[model samples]
Target: MLGPVRIAITFAMSLMTTLASAQEVGSQKTFPARDSLAALDDPSPDAADCLRGFAWQNAAFDVQLESDDATLRSVRFPSPLDTGNPINDRVTMKWYVAKDKDGNVLHRPAVLVAHESGSGMTVGRLVAKTLSLYGVHAFLIHLPHYGDRRDRSIKPENQDVVTTMRQAVVDVRRGRDAIAVLPDVDTSYIGLQGTSLGGFVAALAGSLDGGFDKVYITLAGGDFHSLLVNGTNEAAKMRQKLADAGYSGDKLKQLVQQVEPLRIAHRLTPEQTWMFTGSEDKVVPFANAMALAKAAKISAEHHVIVPANHYSAILYFPTIIDLIVRESLPADVIPAALKSDS
Candidate 1:
């Protein structure tokens, strides 16, 4: 019933709307905080109690703890990246504790949250604090050379990304075991979530530990080598440039394959995963996400926030907090409708 000109205008508007929506969803990673955990000179005493079962790996940090009915504490342990390199020094951890609605300590499950070195501790703290609000205990971990070892050195300018990734997985396993023994915490409900490099770490860790209850990953890819080979980010491109200049492809490929999420997918439960990604992410492409998803052998629900970019995607902290708090609640008590939505 509309004239040709009017119809044409309407179609144009629709196209523009769709394009705008896609653009928004493609670029959202806004979590902002640098060296959050590093900002603290001393770990909280309560946090130390949370690490009761953990064994000290070094004076800089410790691991292995059994959860108790009392107050929670913060604790740390050595990460695989602690190669004594001052440029990339860091201590991984299991910190934070979940509580009940009555303010009494609840034996809720614990989770380990990881972030890229560049992102610093802000992302990890945000996740931990938010999870605490949701009655879930979480450890804000230091990746490679961020917290605890911010002054550590960097050995390989072009580090073995895959080996580095596997090391992270190893640390996560140790952290998980240390936390699982806690008294008030539910070991069966253990889970993980991360941002950027940490997100990739979470996916890989989930693949490595089938006992992991659930996963909420953001800005991560399933395939390690694919991300390195086809990535458009400054880091990835830089790695490629280094390779073009002199690095060996065989070594790169070997390392990447060892940590590639695609290769580890068989270890995860498809029903317990959630992946969030930006369509406009320059560091991690949508294709890599898709590839990882396909390789996961699970149909994960993808939360698309239209018009969000990489840096801003994590900025929606309140939303993430809500999801974690709600999802981390006692699984049996969750309403069917809310469960379906999550």
Candidate 2:
């Protein structure tokens, strides 16, 4: 017979193991057949028109610079679309400027960093810092309802995902224009980098007129409907919320299809674009990542597959940072340390 303490410990260990196994199964579960996702490709004919309208409206806005700090600056500008929420109509961006050996500002390559959805600005800040270390000016922008733009009254469940995504694309594109007017930034060499949710936004924003010289996306994929339906973690939760709000079958597909990245992915320059995906990512499945890559016409050489999951992709941050520095900036602009890391 086992002692009472031993029995309790054994039970606890078994419970923990069971939960771990369940999580693993959930993450690795097979997604629905690709045939079911085909409808996403044939979105409403108005989808392209909507995207073009947003681009046109964004170009008409006058971007205003609020602060002018050399190391760090804050800029606020009006968003193209009005969300009916005053707090979300405006945008705030943080700029991290890189300096030269003599402490003089260098007019070098610049990149606009887009933050992940519901991830605030943590990942964007990390990417910005890494770019600055590599001798590039970094501008990190907060999407609607993220970071400093968050409004307490606006809950995720009440918002329209399609509208949010469309707004994000517009905001990201406008961010590039904002960077163009900044001091010590090379407008001709401006690039774009976005992670996860931000990556999805970048795909669409960068596709518009090839505004960005180089586009780098990590942990993002195509087929918006498939990703939300078959994905795990955050994607799963979003799917559930949409379902609760009466979005199902054709209804859900139609709404999400409007913002599909494939619609404009062809506009992106394949040679100037790079994508980083996780082989084991369950949140955005590997198939979805490949779909986006294929649509963008990204060559195998430009697509890097890391041995990580959606959340664990952070481990390869250093590698990605090195690659971005090497490919986006001029060879002489890269710092000695970053060159060594490559």
Candidate 3:
């Protein structure tokens, strides 16, 4: 028969293992139907200042608003990435101004949302609507070579990866600057969110520049090309197919690095960011995401959706996503002014 001490030790070890697995599984799974925001680090003054400038320049002045719904009537300003690329031909951006119940502009926190190319913008639109319902203002942007501008004009070749990354950052900065100048927008309180490629871009933005109080990313990874190369043996083979399609490995790496979120994750503070990933996601696998979180040394919530696949992860966790946006990002700070001039 086992001694009492041995039995107790065995039980403890089993319990610990179970608990660790539970945490991992729980983190991978989505939150309940009632969504909420996760706690984030306090905003630095310098970061807030920078965010304000970004909002003032990008949100307030650059957009041509058509209706109260905040849809784009026309684009008065040019894209920083606009190099006559056919891809940029159909892209558009507009201001999202928050308001109080009385129709006055509410001095609330603002967000600049970056989305994966194309139908992903539709997801951004939903996020904007949800955020607005919660009193937070959000601006949805159409990324390069995606959405309406996805014509032959802005092919992958036309998009200079370095320039694309830099320009996208500038676009966010300008949006933050525009928000800062708006009488109704709270300059000090700012957050950012993105999905897939947008998540990668958001991570780069958060790491390169300070000012964003909170950042919530989904399906983010370390190195873009590396994620492609090492996700699986099958993926590695597929990458070769791309090479066969005429992509040079070195050139691809350079392009992917220009926007690698993991390469820049070290630049962020624990208080400012949180990353999430689906365990079964194949396009951007769970292991690659773990490598990113581990490299950054941040306690990310790695939720696994059990047997769920990549395309299903988004659909399966909308409620959790709503909670993530509400709770993951920092709360907007109240500004001195009570109302916006507009």
TM-score of each: 0.67, 0.82, 0.64
Better of 1 and 2 by TM-score: 2
Judging by TM-score against the true structure, name the best candidate: 2
In terms of TM-score, how similar is model 2 to the real structure?
Answer: 0.82
Worst 10 residues of 1 by lDDT: 33-42
The C-alpha stretches of model 3 lying farther than 4 A from their native spots are 1-92, 96-105, 148-162, 230-245, 301-308, 316-342
lDDT of each: 0.57, 0.74, 0.53
lDDT of 2 by residue, 53-144 (tens): 44532234445454444456666677777888878878877776778777777788888998776554566777776577457888889898
lDDT, candidate 1, 226-327, per-residue tens: 566667665476567558756547766664554566665555577777777777776787878777777665564445343465776654544555565566
**CA RMSD (A), model 1:** 14.2
The lDDT leader among the candidates is 2
Writing each residue's lDDT as its tens digit, candidate 3 over 142-210 gives 776655555653346444555665567555544454445444566677778776667777776676556
Q: What is the full ranking by lDDT, best candidate first?
A: 2, 1, 3
Candidate 3 TM-score to native: 0.64
Q: List the residue pairs that clash in candidate 2.
A: none
Candidate 2 residue 161 C-alpha distance from true site, Å: 1.0
